[model samples]
Target chain A: GAGVSQSPRYKVAKRGQDVALRCDPISGHVSLFWYQQALGQGPEFLTYFQNEAQLDKSGLPSDRFFAERPEGSVSTLKIQRTQQEDSAVYLCASKRTGRETQYFGPGTRLLVL
Target chain B: AQSVTQPDIHITVSEGASLELRCNYSYGATPYLFWYVQSPGQGLQLLLKYFSGDTLVQGIKGFEAEFKRSQSSFNLRKPSVHWSDAAEYFCAVGPKTGAGSYQLTFGKGTKLSVIP
Candidate 1:
């Protein structure tokens, strides 16, 4: 694709329900990343992948948050037992192996009520 | 842990006026710095970055930023502001992991409003 793409531009989930967000990175990009942005705040790192290898996931807020990139080209972020505090925008980004710039997706706004 | 700070919550500049947005960062070692702009309902667009070499780095859309190691600052500037330039600006610090992957730490962001 021309740029990173995320699915389900918006989501509404009841508290305690599970939600899964998806990301499709640009073709041939070797690095992928996930971030969470709260209302009126900058995006915060959640996890990173280098060609299917989960290199780092230190920024994930809690055990309920999980992410995977089994095939390297696509990724998913799943949140279990969603809470009101889980309301935020989930962002995905990807970049070439030798590049510093990461192309971002439109983001998925999740609202837990 | 590295962190970024965008001191100004909001800034209003008239069209054709010079503009500067302040940023500060905290890290034990030299860190990669970046500036990104975000319009409403849009993803962030990179404005500039500083990894090494000359302090002043130029970016797209007539944007530039200077990295000052002494003050731990990377300030974004433009010679003339445009109404189209109104957006939210974020400052970020990249802390390279052991494998060289950059996990970015971003500031809250400064909202820029341009007055025509």
Candidate 2:
């Protein structure tokens, strides 16, 4: 695709529910990133993937947040037992290389009730 | 720890007036600074970045930023403001690169409101 794309632009989940957000990065990009942005705040780093390798997961907020990229092209971010505090905009970005600029996608806004 | 700070939480500018958004950072070495704009419910759009060489870097959408190492600042500027430019602006700092290391630390962002 021309740019990074995220699915389910918005999601409303009840507390303790599970939800999965998908990210389709630009073709042939070697680096992918996931971030979480709370209301009125900057986007915080969540995880990173260089192709199929998941090198950094230090930024993940808790154990309930999981991300995976199987073939290196697409990725998924799953949050289990969602809580009200978990509500935020989930953003996905991709870079041509590790040192290049990242292209971001329209975030998926998740609301937990 | 590396971090970026945007002092102003909200700024209002009149249309056709000059604009400047302040940003400061704390990093060990030469920092890769970036400016991004985000409209409501939209994705972030990169305005400009500073990697090396020239301290003054030009970006898309008639925006520019200067990286000042002495004060540890990278401020974004525009000659004239437009109503369409009203949005949230973010400042980010990150490392150049190395395998298994690619993360960007962003500021809380400045909300820009343009007056007609």
Candidate 3:
């Protein structure tokens, strides 16, 4: 079975540029989550979605960070006007409706120069 | 809100030696606890979790954890560790509420090194 996967595994962007990171959750997964991980630190929650409805976006750092899972499958995290502090790895995870565990994607590593 | 602590930033062990990783959490009630392993350029992999019932819980790759409510700790252990076990370990905690279970707070992570 294919686990969650993220695109643009490595991205280098100039400061003030906009970047979009994509996530493909597992088939039939009802819960999806996004997390940000800085160097040598654990992942921090960013947002969560149940199906197409985003139930939580409390962890998003600022207005520049936006996420959408319109059709209840693919998700995208867009950062507008990237800054040096925005450089980090963005991870996606998905869980089944009745499962307590979440499967994670390899993650997208973004570097803002 | 729940927070977890991994006291050891790094641990070095010889192959076949026993391994134990300490984890402590701060929460008002019994929280949902988990251990995850991450290799370079890979996603976090679930090692084990503690919800309720018996304190000891078993997980994949010969890993086990014991939840101690008295100490607010859920430490991961293995009888004998393999060289392949070298990776970063994370301890996470979440509220026990119905809706808050999905929001996990993770620790700083402990890097494990195995000498063959």
Candidate 4:
């Protein structure tokens, strides 16, 4: 793809429902990242991956939030028992390698009602 | 640990006026810095980045930033503001890493409002 692509650009889920967001990073990109952006706020780092290895999950807010990059090119972020507070835009980014500037996707706007 | 702070939550500038957005970061060693812009309802787009070498770095859209180690700041500046330049600007610092780790710490963005 030309750039990072995220699925379900807009999602509305009832409270307590589980939702999954997907990301397809640039092909062969060595580094991928996930971020959460609340309304009127900047994106906050959630997790990072180097190839198929999940090197950093320190930014995941809680056990309810989980992410995986099984094949290294595609990633999924799962939120269990979503709450209203989970309403925010989920962003995915990719970089050619670590320590480089990231290219972001259009983001998935999740609205937990 | 690494963190970023964008003091001005909102800034309004007239078209053709010079613009500046303040950013401060905290990290132990030399940190990689970046600035990104997000237009309304769009994804984040990289403005500029500073890794090493010169303190002043030029970026797209006629934007530039200076990294000051002593002040722990990397402020984005543009000589003239355009109406199309109105957007949310973010400042980010890369987390400490060895070789294959990639993480970004971002500050609450400053919203740039252009007044024509």
DockQ per candidate:
0.70, 0.83, 0.76, 0.76
**Where does candidate 1 chain B have its weakest 10-residue lDDT segment?**
B95-104
| Local distance difference test, candidate 3 | 0.93
lDDT of 4 by residue, A28-51 (tens): 888899999999988988999888
DockQ of 1: 0.70
- Model 2: per-residue Cα lDDT over A14-105, one tens digit each: 99999999999999998999999999999999999999899999999999999999999999999999999999999999998735588899
Model 1 alpha-carbon drift over 4 Å, by segment: B96-100
lDDT of each: 0.92, 0.94, 0.93, 0.92
Q: Which of candidates 1 and 3 is the stronger one according to DockQ?
A: 3
Candidate 2 chain B weakest lDDT stretch, 10 residues: B94-103
Pairs that collide, model 4: none
Candidate 3 per-residue lDDT over residues A1-113, each given as its tens digit: 38898999999999999999999999999899999999999999999999999899999999999999999999999999999999999999999986778889999999999
Candidate 4 per-residue lDDT, tens place, B16-65, comes to: 99999999998888888999999987999999999999999999999999
Q: Which candidate is the best by lDDT?
A: 2
For B1-116, candidate 3 gives per-residue lDDT tens digits of 57889999999999999999999999888878999999999989999998889999999999999998889889999999999999999999876667653778999999999999
Model number with the top DockQ = 2
Q: What is the TM-score of each candidate against the true structure?
A: 0.96, 0.98, 0.97, 0.96
Better of 3 and 4 by lDDT: 3
**Per-residue error at A70 for model 1, in Å?**
1.0
